[model samples]
Target: MSNNIKNIVYRTLSKAWATLLEINYDYRFKDGTWKRISRESYDRGHGTGILLYNVDKGTIILTKQFRMPIYHTNKDEAMSIEVCAGAIDDNDLPESTIIREVEEEVGYLVKDVKKVMETYMSPGALTEKMYLYVAPYSEEMKVNEGGGLASEHEEIEVMEIPFSKALEMMVSGEILDAKTVILLQYAQINDLIKNRE
Candidate 1:
């Protein structure tokens, strides 16, 4: 409800996997002039992402899954490597959502997680605020062979790679997911895991 904005109108364009809305609004510029603008926003809601690292083992857990949008753009590299993440439910907080996703997606029952940052995956067109976290993981913490949920039609490949290798992948453009790259870089900056042998 800023004075700079007025005469807002919203229309739903589609509602399936995510809600698409058409918006029209009047904006008052710094010159004291007003202009009417129309735009569309895709609302898939907020989500959380966590990067699990093993300090002693010098390794990290990542997931590989097929992204339809990425598939549309890069057919050869449709399988995207990313941190464990999931959409936040209306009833759930960011921390809880990530914890549950870690367990469901990576098969790790991690209770203590340190939130690193919150980011918008794509601010321009999609309204998805990503809560990023880092957590310590060990072999004992793993509860199952997580490949994602069948009900959600998620087919994920769990990866346990060395920290240095993860960094190399990031630099080589193998880790294309922005959230995953950010969390990996956070781990590197914070020395969460051993960078070299």
Candidate 2:
């Protein structure tokens, strides 16, 4: 693999909330030839997402918010329904980041969370690894009214829906986010909801 890589050059395209770079590289083909390629990649760092479930209620917590990128591409479908998620800051681990995001986005203070999976959300054009988690929540965990942080322009609307209904939405395309869909499917396939009941 090392011998196949000839050269790699990274050029910065933008450095806003996320860093965008134009990558130029040379690869040695199997037929003993070299090919140059250029690709653009967005680096937003790693992130964490959590699916909060209430076993007694047979429901899961979700959040709705406007995504500008989605809005620009599909005006009709601007708002996204997603599980509680946030980018992991430099100082915090994935576990702590998701815990804090859960409380801030859904008003649930979860102490025990299980890390289920790790995935590269969009490896083709973005450099972001998402740590997926699941946590149990009860009524007592709701200590505050969570709508996300106003300073970050997060206007999230918390929603609690039955696990079955969330599955239906996933099939019907109402729930479009990739990470959210993965967690919901994981919950169903693993009988997480049924076991709770």
Candidate 3:
């Protein structure tokens, strides 16, 4: 509630790529005590991710790209396999953003996308809520050679792998991205793959 917070102050630390804020606020405890706290939150805005599956073929589309953060952390391997995703810019809806992302990142124009779930990716420090989706696709959906937007410095490699193999990759630690894993597991749990046959 608004009454629980007081003396809130926000300082911008960076605004180049995304906005980062250092926030200080006073909170009222359950015992009626006030405590001041300081925290930093990175606000890059909310985004969406979609797992493209071909039930008939038992395959899913994934994208491979170089992730700078992962490169810095791992030192050797930097390319990450993940579902097609992007941030919702301006006032665009999450579903619209994901549909555009799917086209741009994987070259697929999909209809009948199902909203699976929405979750906060990193609640501890970052403010990002990701909308997850799944869509059934066929070869006719391919409209262009999707490699992402070069203007945004995106060099994505599109990959179509068997659903079973993707699950194995998750167990083998090859698919490390949380959203990708969650969507993959969702497909399995919902019997989306099995029903395709």
Candidate 4:
């Protein structure tokens, strides 16, 4: 939490976890007049996270997992070609949540989690914050036989694909995760990714 965030006026407009609406009242100093300003009511939502890594001899490790919401929209049984990501659950620390999610979705421990980008997943009406994390592959990283816990009812598949192929997938529009695109773009700028040949 930064100093700027410590004093933002928060007023609740609606109450719902999925669609929490609120307004931030701001007091601005303008030409000897203290003005009371307000922005439109927006929803507050849990944040998203991501993890990226390179491994397996020029391969970028990825996950092929099932997403019920995505499957519901596309009318597909399983949603594949997703990056390792998850939503921050109920006050869960961003680092810890992403670490757990990365392990569950891809079966590996990522090192050097770096905060890449933070933006709204959907800002039109639904307020979802997305945090992008980048990591380097370490030799000690191992993939154990683990899908998300059955009680949590998660079924994930882990895979490693050549970096070039991963870029192709992105180009062909196979990788559709919102956070994935943002992270991939950041990786490209930061030279975490190899140029596509």
* TM values, all candidates: 0.97, 0.97, 0.95, 0.71
Q: Could you give candidate 3's per-residue lDDT for residues 21-123 as a string of tens digits? A: 9999999989999999999999999999999998888999999999999999995668999999999998999988999999999999987789999999999
User: Model 1 lDDT vs. the true structure?
Assistant: 0.92
C-alpha lDDT (0 to 100) for residue 155 of candidate 3: 99
The deviation in Å at residue 190 for candidate 1 is 1.4
Candidate 4, overall lDDT? 0.67
Candidate 2 per-residue C-alpha lDDT over 34-147 given as tens digits, one digit per residue, 9 for 90 to 100: 999999999999999999988888999999999999999997778899999999999799999999999898898999999999999999998999999999999989989899
lDDT score for residue 100 of model 1: 89
Model 1 over residues 73-99: C-alpha lDDT tens digits? 998779999999999998899999988
* Total backbone collisions for each predicted model: 0, 0, 0, 0
Q: Give the TM-score of candidate 3.
A: 0.95
The residue-level lDDT of candidate 4 at 11 comes to 64
In model 4, where do residues sit more than 4 Å from their true spots? 1-44, 76-78, 195-197
For residues 1-197, what per-residue lDDT tens digits would candidate 4 score against the true structure? 14222235766665654544455544535344445555554555456466466643556667777777777778553567766777788888777888888777666776558887788776765666777787866446767754666777777676667667777788988888777777777776777766543
RMSD of each: 1.1, 1.5, 1.7, 5.4
lDDT of each: 0.92, 0.93, 0.93, 0.67
lDDT, candidate 2, at 184 = 97
Q: Which 10-residue span in candidate 3 carries the lowest summed lDDT?
A: 188-197
Candidate 4 pairs with clashing backbones: none
